[model samples]
Target: MIGLIKNEFMKLLLRKKVLISSIVLGVLCILLCLLISVAYKFTTKEAQIESQQYIIEVFEEQLEEAETEEEKNLAQANLDEAKASLEIIKNTPSEDDPNWRINVEETINILKEQLNGLPNDSGEKEEIRKNLLEYQELLNKDIRPMSEMSPKGINMLGYLIAFLGSLFTAIIVIIISSDTVSSECTPPTLKMLLTRPVKRGKVLASKFITAFATSCIVIIGIEIIASVIMGLIFGFGDPAYPMVAGTDYKITTVNAMIGKEAIAVFNSSYLSTIFSVLLKSLLLQVLYIMAATSFFLMISTLVKSSSASIAISIVLLVSINILKVIPYVKPVLPFLFMTYGNTTTVITGEIKISTLSSLPSPIFVVLIFLAWTIIPYIISHLNFTKKDILV
Candidate 1:
């Protein structure tokens, strides 16, 4: 058994394809990072347009720059007289308080007038829009949507990362799942391996371990590298930016909602950010590939050609989408192998999730998926050890 594991390890290590796959994953991570950065820029621009909220400094300057001496005097008198009044009006304006409404209208008109005065060049507008859209996205900070001046979420970026990551990962899991077993079963080497002094179970175990390790090294490596490059380029601070989708903005941010000290309380380290992303993504791919490794390792024992395992795994993955929509099967939700996969966005701390909210705790969710691997894996091992390979 020990000798078999060693041989399998050497085989996996020597494969050039593994090395190439790792390299490709790294390059793809860099590309993913660039895409995320672009998304940040687009989100910021759209948020600025929809919010239409001007900073106090800009409003203050406008107050001093009204056209004539009388305009300036009126503005100065209002600034002194209505400091509290305007702010109250800003916060809760009555329809009768036309003064509050007029002030806001004047400011917006001035801003628009300035914007219209700029050249109609597309390049210039794009540049200005991009500049106005600057926002900060931190690694592990709470994110809340700042749209509509209320509480909601803008979980799109984190979810988008998880979704896209989950997608590619699911595809890779399919490819490797069947390959682990079928490749061994169909090859000339399969017979020799089984007939060796070693027990059949060890050989099966080796397949699972090798493939699991390969997948971890590949998928985790890709996400980590991509996140680091992207995080650095976009810079980290706070995920206070709003994502404007269609006509609404979704925001997530740490509740500096309490007091002056809350600002410092919300800060998260770079490693925390990386770790959150890593764990979330790792949790996703691990459970997915683990399920694949187990089922296929069993299939490897049954099939004559590695190609069949590959085909079967791909078919199974595609079938998962169809199964998710079935009403009758929804009751079996937690037990489904596909159910354990996406733990990434759940880990981002960006959403307004309660700690106790998931159908099961994240810990419970992981344990269930793990059973998919362990239960089948042990059975395959026992079958491999006890059964004759001559068939």
Candidate 2:
């Protein structure tokens, strides 16, 4: 059994298609980095200038609406602070400006002072305090910021893996899984395997195990390469940077939520060790990808045509994802495999959840995933072992 599994793994590694897939994944990771850099270059400076101007306008309106002495005092103070921040934004000419760091530090200090003036017992006030303190730390340390307002290194890796990386892994799995049985059938390898003393069920199980192992390697390899390349360019950053996660379990960097940190403290640990946390958080997403892979493998085994299986898998996955957005259909489809595929969101306890009463527990999501994984493989096993192979 061990030798059979090893042979199956070797067959995958030796394939030119697998080599091509790896190259494609690498190139895509490089492109993700370039795209992020370009976006940062175009948006950050303009956003700073425009955002300060917007804040100034907003404070002026609030001052006009103030109806009491305390309200007026708070409004006037905020308005004065906004005007000062706008001046700072204008004085710092470029990202390279030495004054830029000084101006940001000063602005953060002002925010910290403002945080203390708020009602101490208010939940909203405490949220504001954390945001101020967080930005104060970021600016004082001169941490490189990205579009996600996270430290550049961790943000680049985490965002890439969470969004594009998940899709890329799914594509690779589909490619490999769709080819697993059909490729063998096309070349009469299935018949040769059947002639051996091994039962057909064992042969099928070997293929499934090999595909699962290959998928694990593909996911871990892509993330490692992306992390190393981006870290080299952007600097690995302080592992202790802070972040706030929303109710949906999605993360928001301290820099991103500069003025509003109402999120619970569950993300405090994640903030302190973002790089490691990101990798660990992504394991939930990886399991989601694996569930999809198992489905495709089952399709390939039962269908016996690589093209048909690949096409069906793509369409089904896409359709299910799109269906998740429909209010009417989404709630009714909890049992659907795709419903549990977003384990990241489920585990995060998002505000907008799939469950009717509230967000489903992570354990519940895991059980659904287990059902998805076990049922497909069982069906595939039964189908492959009983079906007559055409030579």
Candidate 3:
């Protein structure tokens, strides 16, 4: 059995189609990374970016230009001050009017009057009260800070590409595995194997192992080039890329979602996110391919020609892909193993997570879907082994 597994493993690694598929998938991953990274560089102004620094410098000049003694005082404030000022500008009321000035003047007066009314034991309260007023004024300014989080649209797009890759991966793996047992059972191979007096069960197990082994190779080969290509194109060492080896970790900041309220930005790191996205993406693909392979094996056992396997496999693939598109059925979408190919939803932090578990921890859903895949696989194997291949 071990020898069979080893042989199957070697068989797939050497298969030209498998090798090419893996390379292409890897290149795809790298290209995606590069594209996303470049988009991020232009869109999300980083701390070290020239534009970011230039913006800060221009802001400082504007503060100096404001010439009000308070503005000059704030000019000496650190990056935090610039950041705060920028935030104020970001949040400031928009309109062309002097009433904006009135609003500021009113708030300052109220703070001043209140401070004067308070009999201070020490001058500490007055200084703090003054700084608070200054801070408030800064908030009313027009220049805002760069967003700290990556653009939601872009990241979502990246997830989509990842998801698409996952979908195709399943189809590819299934196509490769579809001929495994069914081909052997279809013609000269089947009669020859039976004549060799190999146990029917052993033969079934070998075929199953062979198919599984091939699926694994397909996954590994595709991802290897995809990830590497993404890394090279994107050029490494950015904010999303983390320093840790942690898996399923999420990174967030005070980022805007679909509303005005500033929610904490949970910008999950790239590696774990990508890994999780891919794994989860491939998960459904794995299941679908399994089903495809099993179904074909069953057909091969029952039918007499390899050509029948091709037609049956096509029908299965098309049916599943089409069913996935139905609107009402989309919500229960994750149950379909082929659904794992959707890297987008799985990659994004769109879905709520339990504080008790890690982000992208669709563990329960995956387990259930896995059960769906495995049960059919086992049943198919049993059917092939025990039921006479009447063909």
Top of the candidates by lDDT: 2
Off by over 4 Å in 1: 1-3, 13-28, 45-47, 50-161, 236-288, 345-358
Task: List, residue by residue over 55-174, the lDDT tens digit for candidate 3.
Answer: 678766767686787876666565456676555443332222234455455555656776667555333343436334443533444312212223333233344345444466555655
TM-score of 3: 0.52
Q: After superposition, how far is residue 267 of candidate 2 from its true place, in Å?
A: 12
Q: Write the per-residue lDDT of candidate 2 for residues 1-391, one digit (tens) a residue.
A: 7788999988998988788987887787777778877776645657777888888889889989999999999999998998898776665434434566665566566766776676644444545554555555567566533335332566666666655533566677787777788777766778788888897777877887788778767766676677777778876666665543333222223464452122333222122335444644577666666676678888888776667878888887678767766646745565665665434445334423344323345555566667777889888887787655544
User: Model 3, residue 36: displacement in angstroms?
Assistant: 3.8
Q: How close is candidate 1 to the true structure, as a TM-score?
A: 0.57
How many residue pairs of model 3 clash at the backbone? 25
Could you estimate the TM-score for every candidate? 0.57, 0.69, 0.52
Q: What clash count does candidate 2 reach?
A: 2
- Per lDDT, what order, best first? 2, 1, 3
Top TM-score model = 2
Query: Candidate 1, residues 121-152: lDDT per residue as tens digits?
Result: 32234233322222122112323223222111
All candidates: CA RMSD (Å) = 15.4, 8.4, 14.4
Query: Global lDDT of each model?
Result: 0.50, 0.64, 0.50
- Shift in Å, residue 372, candidate 2: 1.6
Best-to-worst TM-score order: 2, 1, 3
The 10-residue segment with the lowest total lDDT in model 1:
260-269
